[model samples]
Target chain A: EKSSNIENYFRESRLEEFLKLTKVTNSYGIFTAHHLNDHIETFLMKITRGSGLQGMEGIKEFIELNGLKIYRPLIQIPKHILLKFCYKNNILPNYDYTNNSNAYSRNRIRNNIIPEFEKINPNFLESINRITKIISQINNKEKIRLFNEFEKLEPNYEENNISFSRIIFNDLPEFDKKLILKNNSEKLSSGTFMENKHLDYIIEKSYSKSNNFSLDLPGPIKLIATKKRITIEKLFEIDFQ
Target chain B: EKSSNIENYFRESRLEEFLKLTKVTNSYGIFTAHHLNDHIETFLMKITRGSGLQGMEGIKEFIELNGLKIYRPLIQIPKHILLKFCYKNNILPNYDYTNNSNAYSRNRIRNNIIPEFEKINPNFLESINRITKIISQINNKEKIRLFNEFEKLEPNYEENNISFSRIIFNDLPEFDKKLILKNNSEKLSSGTFMENKHLDYIIEKSYSKSNNFSLDLPGPIKLIATKKRITIEKLFEIDFQ
Candidate 1:
C-alpha cells in the first residue's frame, strides 16, 4: 500500500519534473549522494538504453542547471564500501528492503545479474574500476579542452545575460560540433537541449542547405542555421523560472 | 588447475619476491588496482576481525606505497559494474570462483553478506556510490593541497619532483606534516617510508631532541635530525635484505 502511493506519485509526476519544480538553485549546487553500485546500475541502464559517452559519463558531481550548479560528492564510492565506512564510523544508516525484489530493473541487477556475474568472475569489480578510472581521466581532459575552446568561440553576452551566438562556433573543430550544440542548448531558458542526434541533424543539414532553419530545442536555447552562419540563441530571459 | 598454477607461480615468485625484495623508492611509483568492492570487503574483513581503519583504509583505493606512487584506479569501481562492462565489451576475462564459497571473510561478503544487504536496502548501491564519491573527491583534493604545499616548501628537482629538508617539514601544519612524510618518504631512491606514527615520532624528536638524532625508517628514506639541521637522504645503497 505504501509502495502504491510511491508509484502513484511517480506516475503523476516524473522524478525529473518534480525535482525541477522544487529545486531552489543557489551557489552550492544541486547535490546527490550516489554510490558505486548506483553508478554501475546507471552505467548499465545507459548502455542498455544505447547512450553514448555523454549519457554514460556517469553522474555529475557538479552540473550547471540554468546557471545553477549540481554536485554529487559520493559518485566515486561503491555501496558495500560505504556501508563498511558507516560501520567503522559507527554510523548506521536506515537500510531499504525492496532491493531484493526482481520487479525493479536496478534491483534485478543487484540480485540476479551482478551475483551471477560475480560467480563467473571474482575480479569483476576490479575491471570496472580500471575502465571507469581510464574513462574519467580521458573524459575530464577532453571536456576541459573542449570547454576552453568553446569559451573562445562563444561570445559572452553581458547585457542579455544568457544569450550567445553560434556563428563563431561553426569555425571550431568538427569533433567539437556536438559539444557546442549541447552547451548552447543547455544554456537556454527552457533548461533542456537538443540531443546528440538532434544536434547532428542540424549540423548535417547546415552543410547541404542554404535556407535558414530553426530547431525547437528541448531547452531554452534555439538554433538557426543558414548558408552564411549558424546561430544559437537563448529564448528565455531570466536565470530562474 | 592452470589458473591456480599460474597464480601460485606469481604468488610464490612474482608476488612474494616483489613484496619482500623490492626496495621502496621515490624515483618510481608502485601501483595496485584495488576496486570499491575490494575496499568494502577489506572493511568487512577488518570489522569481522575487530580491527579499524588501519585495515579499512586499504578498503579504498589509495597510494599505499607512497614513494612508489602506488595507485589503485580500480578501487572506486564495484564488481557488478566491471562484470557488466566486461560483458558489454566482450573482454571475457578469467573468473575466480572462490568468491562463491564463504570459506574466507571476504567470500562471505561476496556470498551472504551483500545479498542480505540488498534485501534490506535496494538503494544500498546508490548510498555507497554517494559516500565513495565524497571520499574520493575529498581525498583527491587533500592530496593536491598537501602536495602543492609540500611542493612549495621542498627544493624543486623538476617541476613535479622536489626534495624536503627534514627540519623544514617539522614546522608544517599537521595536515601537511603527515603528507610530507608520506610524499618525501615515497620519493626516495629506495622505496618505503616509516609508519605514520613512527614518522610522527621522528618529527617530535626533531623538534625536542638534539638536531643530530637518527631514526630507523621502514624504507630507504633516511631521517637524520640534528640541532643544526635535519636531513632526509635516499639510502637505497643500504641493504633491505
Candidate 2:
C-alpha cells in the first residue's frame, strides 16, 4: 500500500525493523559502512535541494534515535580504499541494483554530476571534504553558543508545552532567534523540525504589535504569542476543533 | 596564443575593453542583463568547483572594477520572464552560440544537471534562489562583524605592507581568523586572495610556539610571523632574493 512512497517506506520500515532487532538481540548500537564518497554525494544532494548549513551537515559519525544508537565507522574512508581491502581479502562485495541505475537522484549525481566536477578539479572530493569539515566545525561552535544563550533565557516547560519571553526572543539576532525556535520546536515534537518558512512566519508575527495570536505547525504544534511571551505547545485531538 | 586559454583570455580581455569603453564614454557604470537563471547556474558551477560561501554568493547587482561600475539590473528577473517580455515586444534577442554547447561548464550545468534537479523538486530554482539569498545575507552580516573585529585589532599598514599583533589574531575563531587573513592578503596584494589551504597553513603556524617564520604566497606576498607580530607584505622584484 505504501509502495507509491517507496523511499519513505524504505527508510521508516528499515528503522522500525532495526529497532525491533536491537531489542531482541540486546545490542546497544549498529554500525554502517558509509564512506567518504557517500558523504560527498549526500552533501551535493542537499545543496541541490537548497539546504541550509544544518541540512548540509552531510553525515555524522554518530546519532541516536529513540534510545537506539547508530554509528558510521568508515565515514572517513574512501570507497576505493574499502574496495581494495575487500579485494585483497578475497571478499566479494554486495552491490545495490539501483546504485548502478540513474533512476535514483543519488546515482545520477554519482554518475553524471561528480564526473563533471572531477573534470573541473581532479581533487574536488578532497576540496569538498576540507571545506565541509571547516563548515561543520564552525557550525558545532555556533550550535554550542546558541544553545547556551537559549539556556540562559530560562524558558518554562510544562507538559506538552514550552514557553519563553517574546521580548527577550525579539532582542536576539534574527538567525539566532530562528535557530532557537527551530530547536525548541524539534524538542517539543520529539524530532520534527519546523520549516524555515513556518519559523519566519511565526517570527514575523511575534514582532508584530498584536497582543495575541496563534499559529499551527505540522506536528499539530501550536505557537501562541502575546504581549510579553511566546508559547509552543503540542495540540491535542480535541483542540483541533 | 591566448586562444589556448580562451576562457581566461576572454574574461580578462572583456574587462580590459569594458574599462576602456567606460573611460572613453565617461560613463559611471555599464548594465548587463544577467538574470536569475544565470545566477543559479553560476551558483551550481561554484558548488561543483568546491567553492566556499564567498564563491557561492553568485553575482552581485553592482560591482566596481578599477573605477568602472558594473550593474546587473535584471539579476532578480527569471530568464523566461525576460524572454516573454522580449517576445511580446517583437524583439529579437541575441543568443550566444557557445551557451547551447555543453563544452562549457556553465552550459553543462544549464543543460544537464539543472533538469535533473527540477525532477527532484520542480520549484528547485526558486528554492535555490531563496537559500542563496539567505546565505548571502548571513555572509554579509558576518563580513561586517569580522571586518569590525579586524579593525579593532588596529593593524598597522605601511606602503606595500600590513602588520598586526599575532596575539590578538590568534585569539579569534578559526573561521574569522581565516577571513581576516584572506581579506588582509587581498588588500596587500590589491585583490589576490589566498586559497583556504594556504590560509590554513598560515593559521596553523600562527598557533605554533615557533616565534619566527616566513612564507611566500603566489603574488610574491610574504607573511612573516614573529613572537608578537604577524606582517603581510607585497614583495617587489628585488626582494625575490
Candidate 3:
C-alpha cells in the first residue's frame, strides 16, 4: 500500500499533492534518515546545475512543507555504514532494479559512482560524515536564532498578500534580513527556495520601490515589494486555501 | 588537527571550488547525493536560472567526481526539524547570514515562504517526508544494482581516459551514458558536466567529421574530441603526486 502510494506520489503530485493532505498529528514534525552521501549528491546536483547558496548548503535537516514539520536525523551516517549495519543484522533490504540500468541521473551515482572514493582513501566516508556533522551543528544554531527573530518580525499581510518594511528589514542584522525574506516567502508558497540571482533581484527591487511589486515563484506565491514592506500573496484563482 | 582542517575546508572551499574538485573525482566512479530537497532545489534553481534537465537534478548522492566520492544524506529532511532541533537543544547554530539578509534568491524560501501550508493542512512536512524517504530508498537500491552492472560493462581507460565509443555506452542505459560522460569528463580540465548548451554544442560538433575537436570548460578541463575517440586531459597543473 505504501509503495504504491509512494510511486503515485512521484508520478502524480509533483510533491505538492502530499503537502496538501498531511496533518501534523500534534505539534509534531516529520523525519528522515539523511546522511553524508545524500549531502554530496545534493551539493553536486545544485552546483552542477549552477545553484547558489541554498544549493551549496549540502542538505537541510528540516523544512516546513504545507504546515507539516519535516526532519532528517541520519544525515550524518554513510550509506555504507547503513549497508554494513544491514549486512551485520542479516537484513536483506529491497534493491531497486532501476538503479542498475542508470536510466536516471541518481542511479549513475550508486552504480557508476561512489566506489572511487574507497580507492582514494578508505576513510573518506568517515571524514565526510564528521565534516557534515559539524556543518549541521553550526547551521542548526543559526537557524534557531534566525527563526526566533523571524517570529518576532511580523510581515504585514494585506489583501491575501504579505510584505516587510524595507526600512525595518534594513535595520535588522544582515542574517536576520535574509532569514526574514526566506521564511516570509514560504508563507506564500510551501517547499520553495529562491535562487541567489532571484533573491538579489528581489532585494534590488525591494529597495527601490514603495509601490506593490512582486516576484513569481513555483507555487502560487508572489513576492510583492511594497513601499512600507515586502508582502507575499496568492494570485486570484490560485487559492492555496 | 581535524577540527582546524574542517574549518579550513569550509573557509578555503567555496561552492565553486568544491565543484572543481568533484569533477575530477567523477572519472573514478564516485557518487554524490541527489535527494528530495536537492531535487526540489535543483528544479527551482534551474527554472530561475533557465537551465536544463541536468540542472533540474540538483545534487546527486552518488556521482563520480573525477574519481572522488561526494554524497548527501540529508536531502530527505525538512527545514523545520533542523530548526526545531536547534531550538530545543539550544544549539545556536551558524546560518548563512546572507540568507536572512535577502542578499540572494533563496532567502525567499528561508523567510516569507512555505508557511501557509502550515496554516492550511499542518502536515505538509510529513507528506513531503514520506515521498522523499520512499524515493530515496528506491534510489539507494538502484545505486547498488547499477554499480554491479557498471563493473561488468567497464570500458578500458587508455591513458586514464575511456575510449569514446557510443556503442559502449548506448547499449548500457541512458543513465550510463550520462555516467560515461561524467566519468570521462572528471577534472575541471577534462570538460565533464559542462553547460547543457555546451554539451549540445559538442554533440553538434561531433556530427561533423572533424578529426580535430576541442572543448573547454569553465576551468582547465579540455576535451579534444577525435573522430573515433575523445581524449580527456587537464589543461592546468594538478597535484596528483
Q: Which candidate is the best by lDDT?
A: 2
- Model 3 over residues B145-196: C-alpha lDDT tens digits? 6556555644446554444543343356544444445545653322333554
lDDT measured at residue A14 in model 1 versus the true structure, 0 to 100: 39
List model 1 lDDT by residue over A105-169, tens digit each: 66665676556546544544544444445346546766797778766754554422333344565
Question: If ranked by TM-score, best first, what sequence of candidates would result?
Answer: 2, 1, 3
Instruction: Look at candidate 2 and tell me the lDDT of residue A118.
Output: 78
TM-score of predicted structure 3: 0.40
Model 1 has fnat of 0.00
Number of the top-ranking candidate, with TM-score as the measure: 2
Error of 3 at A188 (Å): 4.5
Query: Per-residue lDDT of B42-100 in model 2, one digit per residue for the tens?
Result: 87776666677776678777877545689999988888999999999999888766333
Docking class of 1: incorrect
**What range of 10 consecutive residues in model 3 chain A has the weakest lDDT sum?**
A98-107
Residue A211 in candidate 2 has what lDDT? 89
Question: Model 2 chain A: which ten-residue window has the lowest total lDDT?
Answer: A1-10
**Clashes per candidate (backbone, < 3 Å):** 49, 0, 127
Provide TM-scores for the models: 0.41, 0.79, 0.40
Greater TM-score among 2 and 3 belongs to 2
List, residue by residue over A148-178, the lDDT tens digit for candidate 2: 8887666898878888989889888888898
- Model 3, residue A20: what's the lDDT? 48
Write the residue-wise lDDT of candidate 3 on A15-130 in tens digits. Answer: 35434444423336556566677776665444344443344456777766545666877766777788899899999966545323213545444343334333334554554444
